[model samples]
Target: MLKNLKLTTSIIMLSSLLVLVAGCGSKKANDSKKEISVALNSELSSVDVSLAMDNTSSDVMEQVGEGLYDFTAKGGVKPALSTNKPKATDHGKKYVFNLRKDAKWSNGKPVTAKDFVYSWRRTVDPKTKSPQSYYFDGVKNYQAIANGKKAPSSLGIKANGKYKLEVTLDRAMPYFPSILAVSASFPLYQPYVEKQGKKYGTDAEHTLYNGAFTLKGWNGSNGEWSYVKNKDYWNAKHVQLDKVNVKVYKTEQTMVQQYQAKKIQFTQISGSTVKNLKKDQDLTVRKIPGNQYLVFNVKENKLFANQKVRQALAMAVDSNKLTKHVLQDQSLPATGYVPYGFNNSKTGKDFAKQAGQLVQNNKTKAQKLWAEGLKELGMTSAEFSILSSNTETAKQVDEYLQSQFETTFKNLKVRVAAVPFNSRLSKQNSGDFDTVLSGWTPVYADPTDFLNLLMTNNNNNNGKWSNSEYDQLIKDANDKYALDEQKRWDNMEAANKIAVEQAPIAPLFYISQVYLKDPNLKGMMLGPLGQPYYKDASYK
Candidate 1:
């Protein structure tokens, strides 16, 4: 009996040990299951949707800030917080939207139409000092409010009851719905903003989200942030990922290292790294429209005030070689303000080629023009500095341009000034630099977004290039009484022609976006608007 009892006890002990071992193994497997990690080259500048400018911060905010409308992977506009498409009335000036009753903030407060109205008013209010105030020009009285001549209440947004929101545009904008899809134009929760007061959006606790994810742990200065699934999100059932991990690195080398270590699943590669990773299974490259150019400070430098001098400087740079050899992305050389893929009509020759023919490559013509401009300005040798961000890519491009301009233009001394990105932007905005390198991704898939950036009165027009004709063209396009697509296109194209001919801004090649994705990841989509959609993104 004793021997039998000993054997049975041993069997029970063995069974318990096996159960514990299996439990631990299962837990390890669960932990090892695939999770998506993204490594960015910069830190989040701000979580405030209206203030986000950089890609890294914008990417995170897109997942956290729920817009009434969203762009799908297939480039189709879809409803997110809205129940359906907005209704237009009063000759396209007024818009009515019905919010989803189920939409709630991450803090469990009901999201109402008042939230959008408050957000719009705040963005246009002069006291807010929003860098994106230019976007509100489409709204009625926004310009007056931004100039401090009108009250914020005069802005054209209203709340009817608890769920209905109304907006009045200064003019009919066919792309208005698309504009709402951008984070910069998205609505913020009013109560949440008021509750946080001055601390709003500086930390994870200060902001409220109504999207698929809610920020859990984030300090503004640190590069590390994590987003956990929002249980209160109206469409939480469709959210597949449990969490998203974002790690920021200032350089691509550091990001690539983390990616190689399997700590991150996605990154952007360029230059030598692009060549090195060409054969990697996870590497994928696509040609997208992004333009980099040198904008002359005509307001500060009299040399750039002359159209011939501007044109001469533009002609001196070999854009084709810069795109083909330096960028190595098969990028088409730029010759106009609007990018080729940026469409204003349904049919035409590619914009890039058509614009290229208008401005032919001729170094001899450029030299003569430069000589004439020098005589007009009464300067023996033109000396001006080009300011750019201190990124490695910017450094390389600056060096290349310095060599090209010095070699081509006789009696010209080109100096490069590199500063941090934020500081560089501040300097450019203050008109403290002679020339600056910058680019714009259109807020919508329209030519106006790019053209409007150079308008004389536009706040975002860093170059401060002003012309009555240019302003008139933009004004006519925005006249409340007119609603003609063909006329609008003509006016915009005319403005673009003027911009190119005047050469206040040098056109550069449209950039191609390159991103790396792991084999296990799926549903990751990149849009022409330059925003990443993570709503449907998942990993196996």
Candidate 2:
């Protein structure tokens, strides 16, 4: 049972690097100019939307790459490039999309239906090795191509004409439209990507934009980039801000100081700053649904093979203390894999309660389980190393866990190893650590968005925990013959229950997003998935 759990966590830490823009000292001085100044936590690796995986990079690319569909302010799907909702036929196995004739790239090229067909094929191609390729499994024949059993063209997506796209699905996906809004499904200009070769999407001049904003002076790897209004955008007149100046800061304190000095319009508050700025009139505190967890490398470590040991370690964690004391925010303690407010079903509620029953804060029980687990493994003392990013929050969490575990289990020696953020992420992806701190941002609003990440074969499942029963349940949930909505949800709930019972991951806490924005900023809508969209955002 310890081999089937998949864990995902989300938390933003403070960093110190800042991008200093030449000129533009004050907002008043730039009032006459048409530019919006924004601050981010890190430097963007690339402006290419499809290649980006992290929130910091994806948020920027969302502005440059408009999807065929987009999420509305109310969290519903809205058409972007498509003229209307897709037409389903052949018992929900096939879908046909009619494109808007006015949709065109910033370079004045028509946004053809073939662009999507090419993009989807490129994403799932084995050679491309996209981290997000797992999302395509729902599409018909995608798994076959990924597994080398079928040709790329065999995947059920094709252009009916220049402006019509036909897509075939393995089953009826309720959240299919929402999936289309994600960057991975966004249309890619095949001609442009091929013509520019390595330079494509590396800079403003290297690519074309179809969204409200077009890249101005962005060199993909640079700390500073600018977004100008796209003249060829279909709804260009609705774009209020003329230009958006983005600067990257690696630390929270640096960004806070810049925000205080009015160097930038917004920044995320962290550490001691959260306390001081809680009462500030300009600060805004919001709770997001993503959670953080400690993933155990069960495949690599023998000790983690025991379910009792995993459960004991999980019970020893005091998530309430970590969220309230260590990180002074109203972060919710995670009791289950699927966050509260995300879904409501009889099966989901039952499984959540069952999972919650496993969490215990008593050290005595933890010691008993630890001793039994060690005896089962024929060991006296168990020493293991945990990896965390070299940030204040990570260090504090690591210290908290280390102290708690030491007090609970006398025969255990858990060492905390801290590394830079990027290096830590790389090691986690490679499964090079016994345990690692990590988080997940939902690409779309669905239970499958969270459940699919933990599948044994999922790229995001760094721990490689596999379970046949869990895989079968997910397969059944996505099967088209399962017409009952509640029945599908039941299958998902059962799968999540199996995941929690496995205990390969210890759920920590749900992250709360804390931002310091100017009072004049209006129409800023934050979603449960990630950062809010800026298209409708404007100054009062």
Candidate 3:
């Protein structure tokens, strides 16, 4: 989701640009007959909401699965299956949602509140082993249920009749609606899922769709798939695109070549290719709310466990050079874990600005720390591999980092282990790598979304960098200051500073997506989390 594997598809929440291809000629607006072909760099891992962990799968899920709420293109929330916004009660710990009876699953069965209840329970059920189960941390009894200490039925969600749903949380979450909008929070038809069992979401046929489109032509192992408009969807009339054909291209060069040939409507390009296409009218760029960072395996790697070593590795990379030369995608050098554009509600100041520069690029300081660390560890030299996705962008970035690390730090041998995207994810999740090129796209707008990943014992903490103070700061932000907006913001700022000072993960750059887009494609929406929504898109 780089919002989870939001990579351009990733394991620690990476974000990728949406690449579409369509006919070159001008067309009528809202052309219902029009269809567009697109490209992905990786294959979809799964469509099952509970099981999907990568950005590719999450992208597909976003198209085919309708949640209680949907993110608007303008970075706001809108009711989808729910009749309206839920009414919060019980001092903001309880929520009541009334469903729209018109909502239906792909099977033509009504989408009732029970479906939501079941979906939440299934995610937190230990038997499901959902990687996303930790998303329900504040939901009452969720942790116990996930830990196998309580029954899934005891989770604080219940269906009131067939249309109304009630949710009780252990603590108030002001951004709960954003959480609900995530694909992992989308409902699944119990009967259908049970019937499909392990086969569910393995392919298009085994899965069900209820959003703007239905997944088709995907066999779980193929490099291509289709999103066909769902006639049975409650809002089907609003979905203008008739079909979207998706294919996977292993390199940006191939995607750009397809764009140049007028065979595709959209594609993302990076590095020197972006410079080459700077004069092209079709070139479009937008800043996405995501960060690419270096993850250190502190739990297992003796060399990285030392804070000085981690700090040295982080400071060695010149983010400005990396983004300007190596990336050349206009991605901003990260100020900290949280990227730019997200603002404090009270002061309207950018969070990154308020936090100030936490990790600085200083070769002198890096060398000093490296020497101190080596001495402390009783080692003259160290060697380890940097694991990263085999995408062209990742390869280039890691290669640059390898050069930077090796040349800056004496006696440090950094090997680049470039594997397929999914394989890299597996190694990260299993804590199998020495250091990893990881990234995160916020699932929600709040700073907590990015900060939550590094907290001790977090499911997404692949590096297992733990600090009691850092954990406390995050906990206080979510729990003690949950109702106090200013306090929450302050605590999160503190936590961000703490994470940066410790340098378990080196915040490299804030992702700025560069795309080659056809001007004909109109009304295509990008969610706040960086995934594109094509429900409103049509060729013009």
Against the hidden reference, what TM-scores do the models get?
0.87, 0.87, 0.92
| C-alpha-based local distance difference test score of model 1 | 0.69
* Candidate with best TM-score: 3
The sequence of per-residue lDDT tens digits that candidate 1 reaches over residues 269-378 is: 66566777778888766555456788998888898988888898888788888877776645567777776664434344444544454444578888899999999988
For residues 1-540, could you state the per-residue lDDT of candidate 3 as single tens digits? 222211111112224432222222222223444787777776677899997866777788888998888776555567888877865788878988889889888889989988998889998888887778878889999767867789999999999899998889998876676678788889989999999999998999999888989999898788777789988899998998888878887777777767776667877777788889999998877787788999999999999899999999899989999888888878899888888766666667778888898879999999999999999999999999999988888899889999999999769888999987778878998899999998877776677878888888678899999999999999898889887778888888888988988999999999877877778778877665556687988876
Better of 1 and 3 by TM-score: 3
lDDT of 2 at 91: 72
Q: For model 2, how does the per-residue alpha-carbon lDDT over 56-110 read when each residue is reduced to its tens digit?
A: 5566666777777876555556678888776568776687888888878988998
Compute the lDDT for candidate 3: 0.80
| lDDT value, candidate 2, whole model | 0.69
Q: Pairing residues by index, what is the TM-score of model 1?
A: 0.87
* lDDT score of residue 461 within candidate 3: 94
RMSD of 2: 5.5
